[model samples]
Target: MLLRRGILWLTLCLPLYGETVAGRWHAAVKTPSGEEAYFDLEVNHSGGEWQGMLINGRDRNVSSAGSFDGRKLRLEFNYWDGRLEADFENGELRGAFTRQSRKQVLARPFRARRTPLVSPASAPSVDAGGEWILDVGEGGGKEMWLASFEQDGARLQGVLIPVSGDYGMHTGFVDGNRILLTHFDGIRATILDARISDGRLVGTLKGSVSAMVTGRRPDKAGRQELNSSSLTTMKNPREAFRFSYPDLEGRVVSSTDARFRGKAVVVSISGSWCPNCHDEAVVLRMLYDRYHAKGLEIVALGFEYTGEKERDLRQLRLFAEKYKLPYPVLLAGTTENAQQTLGQLRNFRVYPTTLFIGKDGLVRRIHAGFEGPSTGARYAALQQEMTQWVESLLAE
Candidate 1:
């Protein structure tokens, strides 16, 4: 009887034992550039000690790990091509944290609920699959812009393919009578917030948000041109201007170089603090190396997170050196908001934006996001199509 009572008492104390900042938590990191990243941290207690692992956020997967020592929390996660440190509030398991290199602030820290992390809704029985046009609305019921959504239900995890834009992985979920789909541009927002009606879902949106996104999910029709416009013509020329910045070796390079004088120059715009940029950078490097001899030169411009130009340069240097980037990388600025950084300089659209600078120095094909090979047959075909574009440009 005494042993049974002791066992019951220990079981009741288990919850109290984990009161020292030692449990799962949901965290979001916001870059000064206005990009929000999501993360799920699993913290475990062993021998009165705590440790953690960060799940997927932005382009980073489950490879992130860290330790919590009462007041000081230290975590290492990959960003761009370098590992970044995240420091938690010394003693508390909650509160705002900063990415060391970029100084991006991650606020609204909260303990993750231990309940099943499922959406509080059901999947509608409609064939929400296939490519459907998306028309976002603003106040007064005005249709703002056009985009696309590809619903695979399983693979590709259902993505929002914006028309002539790019904000990678626009995910959706259905709750009760409402259908909610969202993407991050430094914060989580309801890109689509329509409730289920007769057959479809309808809702309002935040307009300024979509203007910054330029991602697209290619249709699986086997390298077919969905849009007839050549990737080398500047549809928005006046808004786009050309500039130059120095690479790590003090080499001053610009979008107006003779090497890219008459060729299609691809300006790869991304931040060194971005995980998605890592994959995009590798692929861009491969494409640049494979096609440079054939009138193809990629100028990678990094919009890093440091508050100072020198720090931004250093971060960019680290990324370039680590990735062995053969292409020239210029430092844009340390600002986190893309609009403030590029909106004033040029008509910059999105991160990981590939601006195809034509022979006339005019912006041409602007491809957004890198749908890696693992994304399946569509990605493979997309790769082939892009390669074909390069081949055509080379022939020109």
Candidate 2:
């Protein structure tokens, strides 16, 4: 009788001791404003190893690795320095998603439940083809987003282009009139849930934040225009851009330092907290590797979200180490004080505003914002243009 009781207990607790969180989980993250953003996560165990993939819209990002020790589960999304730590109970996962590189350890509440994969034969079919203009937000804070979608049977693919930047490629499936799409780029995850009614797309946009979205095909509309010029007014253009800030080691570095003198410099106004800045950093690293010996010098002035200097510097150090950046990243100020910190420039609009200075120390161009990889051809074109411009500067 005692042996039988012990055997029964072991059998009952076996799943708790093992990786029971394997398989598909339907997740919904609640935004601070009480809106819910949904996603699908597929976890697998093979050869004594655990793997996880986050499926949003249509983008699938495989986790670098994951671990499940009974009740506690941890997943790492290496591409964006993100982590999900949670607890499993009654087939439900509840925890937080964090950007591990940040100093403050900001976390968003995340929850998921086990779900079975729907068979293709039983899946609902809908067509999601054509261009759409999405009106996002409400009241006086509305914004417009342009989207292009293509569908084949149940498979759906599309891109959402917002004024700030594109949301990359999203892939998912359409079941009847209800449509779900998602995109995850390491640092951020976006989910769109909508239904087709009267040939209009009505949905909820859930990403870094949540918003109600309504989209429609226009009778006649051209591609949205982008502001092309980078030159911003400065109180004095002839005067060299100047600043003195400490690096991660508390070493005060000045713009007028000998290392930057006579070099065609790229001064990047960036932040460790910005995803667009991350994309720009990758490009800058490539440019530095290619042109550093040819008189190019890149310096980043970081205006971090964390106001605490020590924490902010720690975040910057992590960012630098992660990307293996070769340039100096100096502490400028917090995001709130950015306008004042970079007061010398006229109308500095974004986190990744860049200033190109010729060897003569005159500001040549001030490119505001970045058109990341999601823009596809636009990103390639920008790379070509910047490379040519850098080459010209080197020759001069």
lDDT of each: 0.52, 0.75
RMSD for each model, in Å, please?
7.3, 4.5
Candidate 1: lDDT of 40? Answer: 54
Poorest 10 consecutive residues by lDDT, candidate 1: 207-216
How do the residues 1-396 of candidate 1 rate in per-residue lDDT, one tens digit apiece?
999999999865544444545566555444333433444556665675445555432322332445554344554443322222343443334444334444754442333334323353555544344443444544563322333344444211244433233344445555555544444322232244455455454555442244222222234533323231332234356544466777767788776567767887777777776544665677778788898887788778787775576667777877786678888888766546656645523444445666666666666466655554323454566667677766766665
Model 2: per-residue Cα lDDT over 287-326, one tens digit each? 9999999899999999876588776787788778768999
Best by lDDT: 2
Backbone clash count for every predicted candidate, in the order shown = 16, 6
In angstroms, the error of model 2 at 190 is: 4.0
Strongest candidate by TM-score: 2
